[model samples]
Target: SCPLILVLGDQLSHSLSSLRDAPDGAVVALCEVAEEGRYVPHHPQKIALILAAMRHFAGELRAKGWRVHYSALDAPDNVQTLIGEAERLAALYGCDEVRVTRPGEWRLWQAMQERRDAALPWRLVEDDRFYVTPDAFADWARGRSTLRLEGFYREMRRHTGLLMEGDSPLGGRWNFDHDNREPLPEHLEAPEPPCHRRDATTREVLVLVAEHFGDHFGALEGFHWPVTRRQSLVDLRHFIANLLPHFGRYQDAISDDQPFLFHSRLSAALNLGLLAPQEVCAAVEAAYQDGKAPLNAAEGFIRQILGWREYVRGLYWTRMPSYKRANYLDGQRGLPDFYWSGDTELRCLKRAIEMTRDNAYAHHIQRLMVTGNFALLCDVAPAALCDWYLAVYADACEWVELPNTLGMVLHGDGGLMGSKPYCASGKYLDRMSDHCQRCRYDPKRSTEENACPLNSLYWRFIERHADRLADNPRMKPILGNLARMSDARRTALRKRAEAFLATLDTEPAYGQGAHS
Candidate 1:
């Protein structure tokens, strides 16, 4: 009988060390059951991306002459949970034991452990691929409390010899964030993003996902993401050659027309294990070394994969289940209906939402500012916003999405993930992108002419939540702006905001559903 190994959906790596040197006649199993797909009503395009990638990777494993068992979501014997399916497969194969690499999700990890304790001997393989190990992170996190990401990031640089020269950073500075925040110019044309012609296999999966999840939030016709390892490499190489040169300067800039900007659209591949973090980091480093891309660009891009990505994963392990529930602001308003429908008159909001709906992908700024900012200011519940983010984005996982949404976006964890809530007026958006040029609402006005919803909402956010936010040391400046307002003027602004929020469809009324 062959030894059995379980490969979760996220563990579709070809170079997985666990699969290497396995005894002859071992069976590797990959399943796509309801439990994995229906966890949060994932976008149809996201499901197609994963399942297509898994199937393609599975074919590669079979070509290597290993016994491969693959299951689709609609399989007749579809058991919902990973353990139950694993046990059934093991029994069917008549295998003595099962092995798997450490899972990306904590819930799956605990379930696997519980099953191992009860069932046959199950070996948990180490995920040595990441820059930091769980034990190493724990050691670094020991004793002296607060886990500041910047400090930990410096430690990682030292440990990995990344961005380092002897004991210090290469440029005698640890961070180049100030040099990396320039907004896009009015006349600059964005480079055309790389194209990946979809294969028959991917087209089939797309049809299946669309049929199954027709009522879901995002669009499927516009899905052009890479679905194979070969295409993922092409996307990475394309970014290195075309976009990496200017990625650092305008990474945070938002625009209605230009959604991808200079950002690497490689997060999907990284999350799927088609591209390793080290490989991505090393490639960018090589770009700097070869003088093809600037230091700020290379370092800034590397910081995302090495620093923020790993830090979020570590924090997920340190605090979870409850961390998903934290709503320090005590926001109770329901999410706006437009979030699900993309039917808003606010041009900035509509553009961001349309991009997300079409691609199931949005750059960091769009997520943090356009959609997430609305959720926070309107007092939508934290978990509600987090779930919506997780369900919508292709790159979202519980670990990455929750912290970025709850801490950075909502400021719900009281500034744990970010120094301040990423709150801004439509003026900031107006300065950053061309979104204002095509909208019914004017970005300049706060309470008139079907005014930009963000205008009134910005002031009303501070006014309504002043009691909770006023005492915050970091938030005092914004509160002072609110405090300086005349009582009568502030009352008018509040009335405008209330009137606007009252028209939203799904509300305990957060938005007044003002539409063109």
Candidate 2:
């Protein structure tokens, strides 16, 4: 008897291991279940994008003469869960067993593991499309006190022979980060990202998503994501040709007017398996070798794909089932009401939220420094913020979203992903963007009327966690500065921050807290 090959929304690649070497008569199953869509109130655009991609891939598989059972969300008698649909199809097709690529999130993987005694046994095939495997990453991480990205990144460069000159780095150094942090110049122009024309499949998916998930967090009016390999390649080519040369310099710079200054918009495509990472990184490295793009820009873009993307996936697999609940600093505040509504006086946060609401995207700086930074400073529960991020963004697979929000963004993993909390005052936002120019609040002033809430909240966060951060080498000097403050000055700032915090975050973050 044949085995049922199950494909998920995120696993859209033609080269997927489950479909790669299958027998000639195997039945391929592609499903769009309601349970997946409403799991965390996923953005409508995310649902549309994935459903369209899955439909397109199912068509591709059928064209190659493989038997495909496509399950649309609106179809009568459709099971609402992945595992349920998988077994139902297996039994219907007279298949004795099921086969699938490893799932991207831990919850589904664990669910699959629990069904060992099902009528049709399940066989999981390891996905090998990336630079390294999870077990290999665990092997590298074994017996290490600290796992630094730089160290792992350099090793990947050596293994891949990318931008290397026969055992030596092409630029004499592994990282070009210092040269990549320059502020955006006023003369610099923001290039437009390529928007694909919606085909019949995309239009149908959009309508389905709207009818089902209209009340989700993000707006889908301007839904224009690349849902096919051809469209994704157009995006990759456009980035290399137009935005790459300046990507490194202004990567960290934010603009209230421009939401996607020079950053690549290929993340959603990459996460969905519409584009392969190896080909993307190779194209970037070739641009640097041909001198079409500067080394800093080329290296910076490639590192995001080859270094950070791979690192996070590895960290997620190695640390899952326990990594999601870490609250090292014991943050206990619920996610604020403004996070969903975007009704805030803070201009930087307002801009980021508006962008996410309209486009289902914001660049890395806006994510890390704006929304993520504010959550870290406010001591929001890691799960609350993590779920918000997962619900709001198009690219947020749990493997990536959990690592960034729970570990890097909130520093909730203690020191596993980041050495110190990524907390900063309003001044950091002012320096990074032009957001403060027209805002109602003062970035420089604290403990007074019209002061930016982030300013006092930042100091309050430091004061609350002074003992927790005192021993950290990077925070020692900052803690000393807090120590040198007078009692009156510190008290005023604390009172201001507490008053602002009290106005928001009324719901409990997780549970009854022993703040210690």
Candidate 3:
């Protein structure tokens, strides 16, 4: 009898212990199914990237003489559910048991559990890929009431010895956030981004995705994301030498023209398991040691991978199933139609959506502040907004994307991911990017004919939801701002916002129900 090994989408890491001592005849399963993609109405490009990368990875494993049971989304053999497919393969192979690493999403993990003990002996091996383990996080959360990130982050530094100097942080400070917010200087030159030649396998995968998911959002013409460890190393080296020097400075800053900007575009690779977090962190550490990058830059870069990245993963494991349903502000507004199409007149929204459509990516701030903020201020329902984020972004995984979209962006978790809704008028965008300069809407007016849509919408959102929101400690200031408005001013703001919302019927965003 053979032992069957199940590989989930995000568990694409080669370092997964389930594959460490694989027997010669072991069966490995990788699937691309509609269930995975449509569960969240994933962006067309995000779907393409994962399916393409998975196909490439399966080919590599097959080249190593491993038996790979790869399933395309439209394959006849695909039943579209992991449990059923796993049992079918195991029964065919005459395997009495299955071995696999723990899954990332709580729903998938639960799905695996219900099926694992049904027909065979199942061994759920520990995932060795992440720096922190489930048990380690559980132990940390044991005696503590609140799992605040800063406290956990400091502990992780002590445990991993990253950014630490003899029991203290190297710079006598735990966070360099104050130094990390310098906006992109006009003359700041970005380094050359790395590119990889698409092998025959990847090209074939691309054709399959294009054929099957042609109507999905985003472009696939220049698909060059790293699909293997070898290519991922090249990307890491390229960033260390070229992008890291300025990464810390502009990591939070937004720019309309410079989509990739100076930051490392390695999240897709890192999340997909093409590159190990520790190895990537070590590469940046090496640059600091060799005097190739400044300490502020190097340590800041390292902290993202070693500190925040690991912390987020740990937090996900500690807070599950219940975390997804948290809606702190009780937000229930329908998602704007413009979210699907880049049809809005707001310059910042237009640029951000266009970039997402072109590349299936936008750095953290772009996602959080620009698009996410609009959704938050417009009172978009958390689930609908989160589904949009999950569907459109290439690097999104439920465990990672949900908390960010619902908690941080929407304040749906009531101040868990963020202290307040990441709501801001156009002035913030004007200061951060050049979008305001080109926009037809003026950032200065709160409720004029040509007022920024976001400006009117934000005030309208607060007024409509005032009864539910006025009491939150974090929301008091915004409430005060609203309370100070004269009756005529408030009426004008509501009228302007209502007009903008009414235009959604004809906007590019509401067309075709792209999310459906």
Candidate 4:
């Protein structure tokens, strides 16, 4: 009997660790289960991308002479869960053992672990796709007082020897983040992201997603994701050649008009395992060495793949099962309705949400400063906001999405993911984006009717959480500003914030109804 190898949707790489030295006649099982798509009401585009990519990968495996059992979501006999499919396949193949690379999510990993009592023996191997392993990260984090990204990132730089010059960094510094915050210039035209024309497999996936997940958040019409490893590489090359140079300077800038401004739209492919992070980083570094891109651009771009991305994954694995429930501030308001429909008075939020709805993509700054910032200020329940992020983004998997939302965005993990909550006012958004210029609410007004909700909410958040945040060294300056405000002005800001919070009840509960 041939050994049954389970290939998950996310584990699409040809060099996946479990496939290493598989004997001839080994059966690779790939399935699209209803449980995964309906798990959180995933975006139509996100569902389409994963299903299309998985189908394409299955075909690639067959071409390379690997026997595969592929199950479509519409399969009449589909058991609707990964474990059920695994059991059926094991019986059909008459396999005594099942092999799989560890899944990215804890739920799936736990499910597979409990399946040890099933009829077949299970072989779970380490997923070697990432630069750092989970066990290695645990060892590194063993004695640290605070697990910050900078320290972990430096170790990764040394381990990978990427952008490192012997014992020193290539540019004599580990980060160029300060240089990477410039707003986009009015005349600087951003290059378009490379778009792959939809093949038959992608078209089929789109139709299926529309039939099943049409009520889900995002649009399915403009599905242009790279569905195969070959197409992913093409997009990666295009990013390095066309966008890498400007990516550093404008990485944090946001524009309502340009959704893909100098940003690599390769995250979905990278998360889906169509493109390896190491290969993406190496290509950017090569471009820098050849004088095609600058040190800041190359280093900043590399840091995301090698630094932040790896750090978040490690953090997620280390603190899971409890990490998702972390809500240090005890944020309790439901997510605003505008997140789904982009129907709102605030231009920054409306634009960010619209970008996410039109394409399951938003650059990091727009996510952090606009939609994420507002959620933080409004004290939206961390879990509710986290669900929206997970459902909306094409690149969001639990391992990456949970920590970023709960910790980085909401400061729900206290100071674990970041030293401080990413709290900011409308003024910050005004400086970083063009949204404020066209906004109906004035960014400069904090206590008036029709004032930007973020402005008053920012102060209210600081005031409400002052007891917890006052002693935080990084928050001292903002706390001092809160203290210096006149009593009358502070009172008005609180009142304004109260009015804004009152309106939230009038908005539809997240995921319960159509956008108004």
Best by TM-score: 2
lDDT of 4 by residue, 105-135 (tens): 8888887887767668677899999998899
**By descending lDDT, how would the candidates be arranged?**
4, 2, 1, 3
What is the lDDT of every predicted structure here? 0.81, 0.88, 0.77, 0.88
Tens digits of lDDT, candidate 3, 227-270: 77788789888888888888887877888688888778888888
List, residue by residue over 1-516, the lDDT tens digit for candidate 1.
666888876677888867977888788988877667777778888888888988898898899787899877678896866777877888888888888888877777777777676557677887766787777777777884567789988988898898788999988888888989888887776787777888888888888787777777788887877877799899999999999999999988987788898989899888888889999998999889898998889889988989999888877767765676677777777788888878988777788888888888999988988898888778887767776888888887676777888878998877667766788888888887788889887889887757787878889888777887666788898898888989888887777788888887664532211100
- Give all TM-scores, in the order shown: 0.93, 0.98, 0.92, 0.97
Ranking by TM-score: 2, 4, 1, 3
lDDT of 4: 0.88
Provide the lDDT at 78 for model 4: 88
lDDT of 2 by residue, 1-516 (tens): 898999998888889998877886899999999989987888898899999999998998899798999999998978888999889989899998889898998888888777656767888888887888999999999998988788889899999999999999888978788988877777777888887999888898999899999988889998888999899999999999999999998889999889889988999999888999999999999999888999889889888988999999999999987888788978778888888878988999999999998889999989999999988888888878888888889998998888998888888888888888888899999888989987899999998989999999999999999888888999998898898999999999999999988888445676322211
Off by over 4 Å in 1: 1-3, 121-123, 507-516
User: Between prediction 1 and prediction 2, which has the larger TM-score?
Assistant: 2
On a 0 to 100 scale, what is the lDDT of residue 7 in model 1? Answer: 84
RMSD of each: 3.7, 2.3, 3.1, 2.5
Candidate 4 Cα misplacement greater than 4 A, ranges: 505-516
Least accurate stretch of 10 residues (summed lDDT) in model 2? 507-516
